[model samples]
Target: MATASTIFSDCSSSTTARLVPLSRIRNGILQFRQSVSVGWKPKNPSLNFISTHGRSSSSIVTVAMATEPSATVIDGKSVAKKIRDEIRSEISRMKDATGIVPGLAVILVGDRKDSATYVRNKKRACEAVGITSYEVHLPENSTEEEVLNSISGFNDDPSVHGILVQLPLPPHMNEETILNEVSIKKDVDGFHPLNIGRLAMRGREPLFVPCTPKGCIELLHRYGIEIKGKRAVVIGRSNIVGMPAALLLQREDATITIVHSRTKHPEEITSQADIIISAVGQPNMVRGSWIKPGAVIIDVGINPIEDAQSPRGYRLVGDVCYEEACKVASAITPVPGGVGPMTIAMLLSNTLVSAKRAHNFE
Candidate 1:
């Protein structure tokens, strides 16, 4: 059995070394954690392939790396900022020409900290881009009827162009029924069945696509990643991201395969894809071996794992193990700064579009 000490030695060499999958070396290793930052050099340079910074002398582990360019870090944060800037300019123009400003209304029915943070971020994003933000916060015990009433109010308000109900509503409430109440025209989060249905059908378009999935596709487009005729794999089948993402990719003329819990040998399918969008929400679930060299990866999962070294007591990681994927993939998105920002940017975008349509503004 090749032990961790044998696999990773205190040595330096000019030759390259392929990273062996952790699964294969787990039995021989003392511990392993994904690296949050990576730098690539295709020549003689000190390689910090994997960090064992806090380890005891007896458990020190380090691995050599291949002299190849790492995957391009898809800068979704910058791209999203650019999109927001574009929206800001467009909103300014629309307001100047027609006295109309885009507005977004959000209904929150619970006290979930994460949900509140998301709504708060969204409101700030809207304000940053000249969009009027309206929010209604209800207690956890609020009735579905109360939530429906809020949606109805937003729906009837012509000034409010987009409406979103923060997800994972109280267990007592019927999510589908509440989501269905948001007028299809104002469904900025794009959870409305009509929007999803329209997205799945050809020769038809939805009023809005789900923000996260839409953002994933937008990232690919902005990066000039070709989707047409490409083999694409979408991990997970959740309605919010996975399903709609597959539909969106198919619309782009990509041959698609969906990998889910029931998938047997999911790696085989992913390894064959040219583009992979993973929304499984499982941290570091996709390994390097699952990726084809030069493939594009859009990681939609923002999973938090414990990290004592951080101020927050934890850190966020993507569904794809970035350290591994960065080596094999041509381009990839990082977790906290990647698709996260784009989701809000897309929401603002949908609001702008809705306002344009409502006012017949060009």
Candidate 2:
């Protein structure tokens, strides 16, 4: 007989487990329970699942081998903090050595509160890392020519190392046209078609990667999660997060699947992925059942759902159900603290990189 190990040769070796079933004696007397070893080694093991099928009298209990504990909490907040510290230290060294202070310019065309908040947070992050931040806020009714002119001015500014046009520009403005006007050299937001095109090609590098996607990949690398040969699924196909995320994963040598609104049986497809990045805006769209045990989850959704119990009348949740995922995933990121902080961190990082490249500073 082919042993389970031989049959599943591709599976990573961990502790092994044995299932024990209880049987009733004819006289209704309790029989001595036999010991069964559940998988990872006897001391530290892998994931063990339980299922029961028999008459009502039968009882099945899962006894996991005394293995390693539950999955790790991939804390993006702390990770981002560490990255910011490093960036600040490097910026300090560069300023002392060469008197170059990296500068980022943010162009906001409208007055959406959410957009304003994001821009403010970005500015704060830049300041925290010793990067000078320049801002240009145009009226919602500003002309496309005005927007383009503003970008051209930033492009001519030698001190500006990076230029980011806040997204969701006014309805009157052409997003693609305006985005392309920003100099490719200063395209720190990484939305330029040229940059995205380069990102998709082998042996090619982009001037910058989309911040959110870059942040997602950064989280995986920092956590020491191997991506070279893993199966990865990215939920959502938005340009900002999903589409680029899949491309980035491919660059890392991970097999990629994208589950979007048109994807049928998304659960089945997602369950097969060793790494799942849920960027879909739907709240709790990816359930526990959709996850395979021991898979790593990086949730990018930040949706506000009604929660009358709280003073704000709502709470933020990720596309993946956190409570349910905690039971099955090997590691998972929380909603607010996970991908959010990393986005800004990557923005700062890209700015620093842009400055280094521009000044020919190693």
Candidate 3:
């Protein structure tokens, strides 16, 4: 059996060795309480990645690159707000000159409360950006043909420029069939096989990128994080976020590695990355130890877990333990305020772009 020591053998020594605590190496997350400041700071030339300073001879712990709390909190909510304002500005300009307003259509199947909430949020986002929103909420018992008909209707509508089918359709429905029914140009959610295929090709660009993945990359760009030549690791291989995210990173010239469920020594692989996008939906699955100091983290997982202290009896958290990660990562996104808001922002952005292309507004 590989102990924490053996598992972390590759991360031995130096100013830039990967930080891995023995407790995390043994299990998933260590049950400990600590706090660190989460904000950006200017880099000091004198400060550098140094050796472990306060560890006992027998203690199994690694040191972060910097002594000071250097990690910057990636403010996704503020960034999302900025993007929405920008979209709103562009939308106003297009409508004023060309009398053309972007429109987004959503086809939501089933009655999952969470799914309904997401659809509502998307509508609100569209309206805020001056885009019209069209929606169809089909009952759980609706036939696949009925859903396809809705998609076809929206596809031909001149006013509707973007279409999204809310995911996790009823167990009886064929998700793939329904998703492919959407027109390639109107696939704003970017779940169609063709969009993903285009995203994978070097010379090709996706007509619309998956919202969450696009937002993650946008956060990086908004913060001026360099992607070219940086090594990135994406945990999870789901089509929605992880796979597309890795593809986008690769397109930007970042060397990419994907960590899935069967990956061995996941921490070891994650630590090698200059950027980590964790979308496994496992709360706090990534601990501080798995990160490379100075690595930028964009957490996509929004998991709800029981919390006795909360009034709702539960709270949301991301895959990376924020408190721990803040200590090591040069920048990171918070859970509810991070990827969540950005997803809607990207959806609006895509809708605006689709309308612009359809009408050639610009």
* Candidate 2 weakest ten by summed lDDT: 1-10
Candidate 3 residues lying further than 4 Å off, grouped into runs, are 1-70
Give the candidates in order of TM-score, highest first. 1, 3, 2
TM-score per model over all chains: 0.84, 0.81, 0.82
Question: Which candidate would rank higher by lDDT, 1 or 2?
Answer: 1
Which candidate, 1 or 2, has the higher TM-score?
1
Q: 1-362 in candidate 3: lDDT tens per residue? A: 11111111121121222232211210111121221111222133223222222222323224332334646777789999999999999999999999989999998988987679888998988888899999999999999999999999999999999998887688888888889989999999898999999999979887999888999999999999999999999987787888999999999999999987767667778878999998876656676667888899998876555555569765666777665566678888877777778988999999999999999878
> What's model 1's lDDT at 66?
33
Per-residue C-alpha lDDT of model 1 across residues 1-362, encoded as one tens digit per residue = 11111211221210122232221211001111322222222221222344322222432322233354478888889999999999999999999999899999989888987679878999999999999999999999998899999999999998899998887788999988999999999998888889899999999999999888999999999989999999999987888888999999999999999988677667778889999998865566676667888899999876555555669765666677676567678888887678888988999999999999999988
- Report the number of the highest-lDDT candidate: 1
| Tens-place lDDT digits, model 2, residues 179-238 | 999999999888898999999899999999988889999999999999999999988777
Error of 2 at 60 (Å): 19
Error of 2 at 23 (Å): 55
Which clashing pairs does model 2 show?
A: 15-39, 15-40, 15-41, 16-39, 16-40, 17-38, 17-39, 40-45, 44-67, 45-67
